[model samples]
Target: MLGCLLAADGTAQAAVSESVFLDEMPVVLSVSRLSQPINEAPAAVTVIDRDMIRASGFRDIPDLLRLVPGFSVAYTRDNTWAVGYHGLADAFSRRFQVLVDGRSIYSPHFGAVLWSDLPVAIEDIERIEVVRGPNAAMYGSNAFLAVINIITQSAAQAAGGLVSVQYGEQGMAGLLARYGGGDADRRWRVTLSTQDRDRFEDTGPDGSGNPVELRERTHTYFLSGRTDWQIDPRNDMSLQWGVSQGDWRGGRVGEASEPARRESGAAFVHLQFHRIPTPGREWRGQIYYTRNHYDADALGTIPGWPLPVRVDDHLVQTRLNLDIQSIQRLRDGLRAVWGVEWRRETVESPQNYFNQGTLDGELARLHGNLEWRVTNAWLVQGGAMVEHHYYTGTDISPRLAVNYTPLAGQTLRANISRAYRSPTFFEQDGNLVYTDTGNNAVNVVTIPAGSLLKPERLLSREVGYVGQFKPLGLEVNAKLFYDTLYDYLGSQKLNTAQCNEPGAKKCFQSVNGSSLNLRGWETELHWRPLPHLDVSAHYARVRIDYEAIVLDVTSTIIDDDLPDSAPRNTFGLLARYGWDAGWQASAGIYQTDSITWLSDGDKTTGYTRVDARLARRFKWQGYGAELALVAQSIGNTYSEFRQENLFGPKVYASLALDW
Candidate 1:
């Protein structure tokens, strides 16, 4: 009944006319593993194209996500950022899924994305497609909230040499170089980039400096290569490899209260093959390997402390994944996809996060789906995946969706899905150590293994509408969604007999004692009033209810604080203009309502920020050159979550040459 009312409201507001498909409408492929018109996708999705990426004036990859609806972006430290969809965020985001090309980038040790250590550079990206709802049936575990696919530009699109350099306030400097060339049948591209920046100045609510906080600094370097080969008329292959390394100083040190040091390195390789034997049928296979190494050393002496203790953390992990899938036309208006996947993950640490000297895990899955055009005006889609894991036994995820086209330019859809998030290695087998010196001798405390932990699960329902008005140069997407999450990996104090030390204090293990309910509405609009001008707007409202039964736990525990920072209202707007005479400019604004941070449960003031960019292109010796200026938080000083992580005005200028 509520879904019906929402659809009727959208129908009444839609301006119906002689609608025709535009020749240049963007097509997306993340929804069902096949290319389809954006309005005809099986789920609520937002695609940010090259034009939008260039106009956003965001140098980092995570900032680009602000353009999408129902997403939250926050800064934690100098180079650490947190991004979430529909509002469960932490220093390391664990609920969302992120992929580069076809390779999952989630770390096996902690099941989190290290945004600052990603290998791909923003300049090499072609487009980003974000799914606003769960897609576990198609993407597997850890896709419980949303999925982000970052597609890089093909070698054909980058056919020459380019150089770019930028310098800005806050001790920021960046340099990038790329070269691309190939024959008609084969192509290759290579890129190298370096970045350096300073952390936000620690300040109080009144914009005054606080002496106890330590400042941070960061430096990063990256190198990447990609190649594509057309072996024959019916076969093709592509390979990509990259490496990224960075170091930073932050956190707190001993008695004098200095900064600590941390370093990380990552490398990845991906290979893909495609075959097209006949029309209406295709097959593809992919394999990838990733490695990550991280180390942190932090220690601080409290008032009246006698000794300096070690507060260092370290981990090294690797992952290998392979998958194959086939897409075939079943009948006149029906299509099907079937696939299998095998994954292996292994990790090693200094006996800090795992009890054993080493830890390893494996997973296998089989999935299938069907897309049936029941009639000219109706479509139905269903899919399911069966996964087998070493720890949590076998589990199944499923989804069902239906679309109704009542008019030539409008589509309405209703979808329901079941998704799960498998426990990370750290959660299942963690042995973190804490030393207590109150008794004159070290009393080492360890977090016991969660041998009985279960996978987190989500049941979600959503209603969505998409409308296109080519005559008016407009497109709109809106959705209403509800979610119920259960079996979350929370903690509970164990009985004396269950603890390693029978009478120890603070001995805990993970359990399933939490449930969360969330409901929200999101809407996005795009309008092109003229050939050279465009505007986009997005808005969202969300509400949540949470309950947990964890005995004797602090309020800062995971289950108690996960939803505290979810803002009730969020909005963004963007406008861009291009002139025929080699000039372009863009401006944008975003706002988020005040919310309490989980780290300290401190409420922060709501903030509004503005960003802008201006550029001019010219030819020099038959080569293209561009000069641009970018600014963020133009005239405001605000904090996203932490008072020390305040955001102030920033300006930078860049020069680029392409041949």
Candidate 2:
């Protein structure tokens, strides 16, 4: 119904009548693999709809996550971002899983989401569902911290032609064109977009209190299309394909070592067949293939250095997946969903792996969820996943949740889950040794993958509440959690007989050396007064307590700063209103405490950011048209990711037309 209302505009909208009812609470599927209202789900979920997306004035989909509680989002570079949940923010530790239309996009090379290369346009998204806890019991491995499910509008829902253009500060320029058409039985939509942006004014501190500069400007292009076909009364099919490529300028003023062009791209093709034979029975089969490639090496002769052999980043990653699932009613007031998945992931790199040609991993998993209703106000959910991976032979993840309703619009929830994440390929078998241009060893060995690594384990427990205030049109979702992370994958300095250097004689390898206790509370508040006004707010507080399982690994103690990964407090508020004459205005306030990024990231100071936007809709040749002006970070300049990476005010205007 929300999708229908958003797609209708005003002409075909739902009539304003007493017979019509709108649900303030959302129904989500990412929780227990079942479609249930938030009050009944086992996890805390945050839904970002199209209305908020448009009003936020964010050009990148990642920036829109500021509205979600306990989410830390920052830009490490002009073309790269670090996104984390609760704690453990990093550029390489891709702990969480992201799904686009049920297709996982987690890369196999460095275990990171290729944010800059995502083949998705901001405007093409319909909604995003974020599950704010470990969901490995249903999503398999790598869904360690959370799961983000990005749902795009169907071809049928977006049947028209649209063109939008944007130009903003930092030399930001973009253009998008979309066309969609179909009949009742079949529909398809295609979107093509390109964005060109310049690097930030400052690229971070280069030590000596001096600013460092590299041409990190980027130009990106994307082409995404979707097709929906209704084969018969009981069958349907969907085809989704997307391609993206980006070129980033990279060079230093006096150095020839930085790669002149940083290249990154991704492509994917997905096909799914769905069957619904009865009202309470359904099944789906899907297959997908994805490829991601990147080339950005920094190697040049320095003024005082004699060697210019810096084996920088260059890699290719691919994934092929097949899955089948069934959802059905087991009995009265009872439901179940079962599924199986098989996948192959491969990574090819000469720099990181040295002589290793291609590294491959095969994985298979079986998962199931059951929902039982004991009474009119009591619901019990349980699920587990049995998975087999080349890295971790076989493992079982289990989850259980209980929900009780005390009144008409209030519910209480208690949940506990156990999950695991295997060490990434880079952490397992990587031989990351850089050599000189003459193939001679120029640097000492570090992080040599010496010791065997154990898969990280997690035990999470949470108590939550969901409430709806009918008279005030308000809905609240909140949770308090205590999680224990065991077998932490930290690096330990080890004695190596390889190239001996006076400055660095020891190498490092992954080890289970540290443990952590995460305590946090997060909440969401949303209120919408139909037709004119909408308000959304979020807040969270997190504290990480670190403990060492063993600090006697050699002499150095690593990962002690892991407890500083997240801030102590964060909050945000956004409000939008519509007035007469098709005029609309919106404002947002965001705040976060100081945070320290992990693995080469710097500790950044806390800052407050304010944004506002104004727009008006009109008819151009009888076609809907809108012009909007947005101002971001109207406050003073602040640092992000690094102290020298300054973030300043920006203003931009966009014109969107539907024909």
Candidate 3:
């Protein structure tokens, strides 16, 4: 549920008319691509509303995800972050899908979301809906594990000029400005923001394994605009565009890290149209274009090389996607929704692809879901998606769910689903080679892709219970899930016959080499005991088992690291209160058990984080203004992803004004 409403029209519908507890349950639109209440949806979901966003006092979108159950977040460096669900996650969150206003933002080059340069600002988001299990039947490939949908506020809500500025320790500073204006039929808004901060005081060492000190820091800027128009009584449309750019100072060209300076940028344009043919029917279409660019230049010395090597890491990625969907009522108790989608992804990189020219791929999908109320106490939902990809041919993902309601404010749900994840271009066409001044391959980082790669598949089963107590003003959601993954992609050293390329030596290939299984239970509680107070808490327990482990002498996939990548227990708590007429206070506490990060990450011990925020909201000089003070990580230094990177106490102050 999104802490918002979603009527049959499906475009963030206004509040409902009835006031019963069941009728007032939070509504959601991401599950099954249909508008329904939380208890009636097929899967478990977590919603982060605007109020929680402000109370958490987090500037990074990934950092704010700590509130979600069964999620793990790590800071790999100044510009890199890793987020995963269940387990088996590296620097790239390959199995997860993320969207902003129905536009997918997954990168084709690295198989991950570019968190450092996301196009939208947190202040502009209305809410985030996170589906906790496989949802490929509604979304497409790469929705193998979870889905995160970020919905921004409508243009009409941002109808005034607003400004915010902040300063903090460790070179933390930021500024943001927004303005909006329109008439009854048309509305528009624009946002501009910039920020700079330091990530680590000193990087442990360079590639050569020598004692060294390097400061890692980053600076960023973003601009975005949105427009909404109500052309007529039954039609409306929206247009949105944004661009974000950032620069990070990093370590030299070491084995694990690269570049002294890295520049990253992202841009996107999204347009959507909606039509309401009748009171119970609607059609919507969306088209989006997105691009990502990266550039890095550095010089380094290999252990046995005679001369320095020039490292030029440059990459450009682009995506064009379009989709249309329709929802109509067939009868009194039955409704159906269907959609079609197409997308193209392209990548250009000489350094990474080893002289391979620009590469591109295409994908097409068709999907439909039916929701039928069998009786007053029983509801059933089923859907399937068929997708054709340039690499993996065609595949189908399907889901079936059942919901039972014995009483008005209580519901029981069960779901079973299957999903697939196509192999990324990096996994298929990787050719990493280090060249010296003489143009000779000095270090064979990797050879090339294997021709026999296949898509990874997942099977998810879950049972859940949700209940809302109107008198207590409390909500409880709990679930138990079991998941299995097959044909898992892993790396291995290939022999002469196993090498797909002729005359290839010491080939490092990607293969369908392993399987994984996970079982877990998680719970979330939302309590608003008083009119001026809000409290939320969550807990998760996970157990991971490896059916097969891929081992390569030259690879980093160790036996223990694969099974210990996920924490066994996780907990979080959040609280907000209005202490006085103009005073507000909030606090959050989070803890994670010991776990190991795969690929470039390291083993870390259990850690706990605490944060507090105090603010005063009032009207000054005929303008809405707020002054806030925040304290974060109020404890001893703790490691994030690596032992070298430490987190400590920090304080910041900010002022926001609206006119």
Candidate 4:
């Protein structure tokens, strides 16, 4: 595989550099900095462009993420998915942060992301930047493991009409349509899409039995527009707005219930001003506002039992940046960014289901960062953030990093940072009832208000190396990282009868206790061995350990095994061939090691699964088109998340047209 990639690299470099080399290509976005070249950034940043998305023929964001190093996707149901990265899995993956055009996508209620809700259109996405490390100083909380930023294309690039349709196994159907065009100077766009899938019967390891049934349906609509006004020779102002809505359905376990539905949406508006301060200095300022909402119905319950809940949230932020060169010396420069932000949220729960509650709260933060170039080959960056929450206590985070470029196309980088995760309302004052065999009874769990719940802190360190050779047309990047968590927030069971009357039943409290350690390594390689062929592959491994603790004075230590949801190893590979006649063909595969879930002292064995896709593109008259064939679960592996089950099946073909 490596030899094939290296040969293709030499051919591709000779073909592109000789004809299409451009000096002003926009550098992809990075988590360590606002935006910087992939090699210049002091972190491991992965970029998946729109062309790659189309060639892969992936159906959604979760599918596309399989190609990224150190990432895995686990499905809870037909329409719900959990993403794990850098050794952290679901329910425990609070360390990662996700954003879409600078707007937060991580759910504050559960501290996890529902990948299906993110509005990702293959045509609208410009690129996805995946950064592996702690970025709390630049992105605030929930950035201890990694950061994923999805950036959309400018309106100018989407000024046309396009339509696509797909159908496959289990009565699955998908439809998408988009149209937009404006004056040469101003542009706008709109898109509408819907997907529906009939439930499939689940099977056991041997693939035969009466399995559970699962089904799902979803519909989404989006509208956005942008305009640029050239006010002067040195200044230009731009305005943009976007809105989307989604509806979903599915099933629950151990009960007969109607499909649960949820609706979520967001609106954003931003204004920016740029000016030249001096001969080689520049400054930019921006202000924006965002609003989000989520509503869901209870899982399984009697008809008309009243099971509905809603969350409303709003955020306002302002940022300023300055770039100066030769301020004090000929080779020294300074780059600084600072900002302030505020957020308000409200929740309404009427059914008292699923940890329902009614609460309103606000939070504010001040953050800034500065980068300095001490020498031609050495660079340093430092930053800090201070945040205050209405219910949770204040927190301060700091970060430092360095980059050394010993030679052209060869770079080494390292980073050290301190980050934190604030306690959620559900962890502070909510009440829940849970059943445990160890306690031999149903226990009511309640967290007391006004109790000290310190923010979960992490001290992280990373080292990486990246090399790009023009002659070989190959790019290789590798990194290793470790993190130690203090005061990690986790649930613990207590015996209420010990303090109360002997006749009372035992109860437990979901309180904060114990610590955890996580470490991992990731590698990504890109090679264009031939002018018509390209190959890319990624591999990652992670491990996690939670300290032992005594519950109810039994002096029992929690198991040392990692979380059940995190996979120890994951890997993916893609091969593509592009022809001069607009003909394209590609095939790819993704595999994940089995996962183990522990319950009642029982450990489950893990399994592995595979998927593949093939596609072709062509143009006729004034329209461009593509057709693809996809087969998911090529090995037909059976898997389950919690009580929900899934079976791998084949998805047939899809056709797309654009003008």
Candidate 5:
């Protein structure tokens, strides 16, 4: 399936090169396998342009994702959040890949991303591209479900100083500022930004469900610099570097305990040479290092001495591309892209904790892709990748895509691919210790390590259509997809005797589960009746069927068939209006159905939320200023997350901002 997709993409690349310019091209959202416009892609793509971000009045990445179709976001507790696409979801680990400026941000320790820790400022984002299907052939593992890339604005375009301040109810307050500029000849720019948010209260169990007093705080700082040096008219070299830090308090177990604190930092340097020796060729290289640390000292009577865990990772990658349209047949242009990557990870524990043993592992991958144009209306693309993990062995992934354009404004796309997820240290060999009080003394229960876990694989197929009409100023897009899982790694209870030695009642370990099926569809509509008025709506439905399985002890089929942290029905709406007088008003509503909790029998209730914003801008000689107001949860709807395992309080807000 992957091989065919790669071949089709190669064909499309050949056909598209003649009509599109690399610098001026618009990228598709869902087709992360290729960097091409939506009209020429063979998959569902949703492009969230910069204008949409500004009009939505979102102050953070999570808020902005709510407007995207086929995605669901839920707060676990405190400042932690779970976001997923299609149907697959989990509290600590989600099956998706996230990138910022072509760098993977998913944590290797937990196989998930900390959405709150994303460093780029919302105001500096140029666009967000979301692909809602498997992209393993191009993006490698962790792209089993979907891919989300947050592209930031170039330094040249953001050359000014601006500041924004806002305060609202529920102890919410925020500030963001940036200053950047460089001479035309020098072609250099620098920016620095910081964001802070106060902890929000949760719903208590007082029947009336009043706000619970849980203190939480989060902050992030970022600095980036870039310079461009033109070697000649046909050759140019650019260098860029970015560094960011995020700190947050959450993951508390009880009211008497101190909240968990997590800190993460990243630094990256990239160099690129475009139009080197060839007319339409480019080469790029990057090196990055990241560190993530978590301290959970107040967890379950652990005392003031926190359990500390840290991960340090380093990666180096390079890519080279050749566009052969000018030398080859005009209709048979050939484009090829290839790259190599290397990564190393090291983990440490402060308390001599050996459960998750500290180890260093290395990985290497060789990947290449090709695009070919078969005809004016039909194009094909294909690609394949091979990777070797020192501990998990080697695996191959491939993809195929076919795109057909029946009319100038209509596109039909189909894709098939295979992807896999590598096992983490926690899954391979980790020990967990839990304690229970017996007569004022702690009774420790130890969970032994499991060394037999295997990697998970998914085969996915999808088809979609996109259309744009100028007569009604309307755009509509829809997609249908199906995915099958094999060797899905899940934790299951072993025989009672495994841990029944006079104390514990249960023993659990990692195991391979039966195959599962996931199918879903998403639809979105956008209408602009007037130049200044815009309205949009979207809906998503996902269905999952877990095959029956027998418990190891009872030998009876498990009745529950729900996937964890996944909602069945989700929808959203947005409306915004901007006046010539520099005044803007916006409002939005979002709703999501309750999700099952960790394959357990528990369930969470659904809730609806509303948000509103107002802003105005004033211009002076060589400078401009802006003020804004923002509010979230205006409806005060009562909502619970993680199947009632966590809940949020009704919040009201008003904000004053000046820039």
Candidate 6:
């Protein structure tokens, strides 16, 4: 059936068309901070362009990442998603790094990215570059397994105005508007967006519906703007600012839940300057500031109380980052990049820190890299970064890679690297205070110490291959990786009786007596058989072994087994077709092996699912309009995390106008 659809697309060449679409190219930037073909990239990489993003039929950024091999995207709740590269599968996957337009979006409070707080709209994205391997040498700490960079369309490219509206079942409604203008030397663009959706029906781990309703509603609002100015032919400046706010509710069904409601807000500003002093010599300087605030509240009844009690938890964090870099071309076939960065952060959250009203942290880093073409068939690249943090003091990360091109269209690469994840504010000083009122009794709360936390480290090796068939318009990339992690940080609660203090407090703290061994293989293939037809396939296999070696209350060191959710196998296939008559269709199928939920010891059965989209485009009075219908989980209901997280079929329609 899939082959027939691609073959039939050749006959409808004149029935459908798109205003802007491009084939997947070999160009990428995550490897060396410069545009280089995939065959020469030092590490495995994946590029998601605008055309591919549009055809995926995914409304969220995390969902689109599912197309990449080795990436896991799980829908934990109605509005919360957990994304990871190799699968620790926690609510906050903190090992990965994320950046938007050269500005880091990962928060220092928990060392996690707040996907829902990102201000940029999906329509404003131009491309996404993902380095599918550890790259701490180039990017700093937290670049443990992968690095994602999202690039938005420039004001000049967006031009005019665009409005998009979407409606669907389950009280889903969304709107996005963008306006762009300015001359060649000066350009600006502004965007506003909103989304609202109802909660899914209450269900248990066995996929049986409960009597009560689950509070899982979500709503969001965002506003953002960007500007660019060309000071001269050798210099340019860019500025950006954005704000995002949202409210969501989540908890178990048929229970009076604590922390059931959450409100989140984020604001940021970024400024950058680029200068080309001479040929083969370029320099850049950037500064960015971000503020993240969140509040979680809930009302619950106590056993002995006649009324419900309200509890509040709040966190506020602010960060300022500055960086300067220079790219120099020493000679033909030789290039290098060197940079320095400094970051300062401030936190004000009495809930998490208790009496500590506010605190500050700082970090400084220096890095350099060199890409040398040793010979016609051999390429060598090496880099290292040295960073100093308030908690861990100083550390160094280094990486080296060699690429060999034996044939015209084939390349092989071998890489070795060392990466580290610095401790977050929460891990270093979190209190995690909570009250339990049950059976007419109130238990004492625990106070924790995070000051002894240390950074986690990983040593990894990888081998990759990139092959291209120009005649067939096909590209294939495959990689095998093995990693050994030490001093893995984990949460633990110490017994109060073991302490010698007056209150003998039972404190929760971050511990480092843990380790993990992970191995994986992934492959991605892209084929463009025709101008209007495209096909892609991805597959991955992973395994994990983890051990928690810690000191117990008896002062004895013991190694305990830990649960993991790393799937043994996963695969996906996608196809898109377009006709000249303005008709287009896309379909995809995804399958995953059984996975264990580390939290509750529940297992999620393996399942296969399908998604599809169809659209019609029309032009009236020089304005382009499109109407599209999208469907997810076209077959029977399936669970991505657990049965209670069951996601059934959903259909929505959207209309977009561009002028």
Each model's C-alpha lDDT?
Answer: 0.76, 0.79, 0.81, 0.59, 0.60, 0.75
Lowest lDDT block of 10, candidate 6: 1-10
Candidate 2 clashing pairs, residues 3+ apart or interchain: 257-299, 257-300
lDDT of 4 by residue, 1-659 (tens): 00000011111112113222133222544454434556666567787877678767677776688789877665555355656675445533456777664556565555556465555566677667777777777666777667777766555556789898888877677888878777744556676776655433442321344454444556656565555444444444445566667666555443333335666665666544444445444344444444456565433332343432122111122212111111111234677656666666544432212244456567777776677887878888788878777666588889888988888778888888898877655555444433222222133434342376777788988898888877877888888888888876655544565323222244334445577777788898888889888888898887777755665573233333445445678788877787776677776777677665322112223445455566767886778988888777676655544433555666768988999
**Candidate 3 displacement at residue 495 in angstroms:** 8.7
Best by lDDT: 3
Candidate 2 structure quality by residue, lDDT tens digits, 1-659 = 11111111111111111122235567665677666778998989898888899899888877888989998888776367788788788875388878877888777876787778888888888778888999999887888988887777778767999999999988889999999998878889999999987635636455357767757578999999988887777777778899999998755444555576788889999877777788888777778899998887777663555767774668899999988888899899999988888989999877677667899999998888899999989999999999988886898999999999979889999999998988778788776666667766554455545555678888999999999998888999999999998887766655555324332456666667667899989999998867699999999999999964455554444667777888999999999999898899999999999989876578888999999999999998978999999998896677777666677888899999997
Candidate 2 steric clashes: 2
lDDT of prediction 3: 0.81
Q: lDDT per residue, candidate 1, 109-205, as tens digits? A: 7677878889888889877888888988887788789988887877766779999998898877899999999997898899999988774654434
Count of steric clashes across candidates, in order: 0, 2, 0, 8, 34, 10
Q: Residue 646 deviation, candidate 5, in Å? A: 7.9
At residue 226, candidate 5 shows an lDDT of 65
TM-score of each: 0.91, 0.93, 0.93, 0.81, 0.83, 0.91
* Residue pair clashes in candidate 4: 7-529, 8-528, 8-529, 8-530, 9-528, 9-529, 199-214, 594-607
Which stretches of candidate 5 lie above 4 Å from their native place?
Answer: 1-26, 29-34, 206-213, 228-231, 234-247, 251-275, 299-333, 350-357, 434-449, 494-507, 554-561, 597-602, 620-622, 643-659
Which segments of model 4 are wrong by more than 4 Å?
1-26, 91-93, 198-210, 217-245, 253-332, 351-357, 432-450, 494-509, 554-565, 596-609, 640-644
- Sort all candidates by lDDT, best to worst: 3, 2, 1, 6, 5, 4
- What does candidate 5's lDDT look like per residue over 1-659, in tens digits? 11111111111222324244333224452353344676566556566777778767667776677887767766655455666676455554357767665556676655657676555777778677776677776667777777777766655556667665656555555666666666653456566667666534543432245444444567777787766655565544456577777676654335533445656565656554443345455444445555555544433444442443222112222212111111111234456666666767665552222334465677777676677777777878887778777556898888888878878778788888888887765455433434323212122132434455667889888888877887887877888889888877666654547644233455455556777888888888888889998988899888887865665654333323346446888999888899988998988888888765442223556778887778787775555766667666764645344332333332333332322
lDDT of 6: 0.75
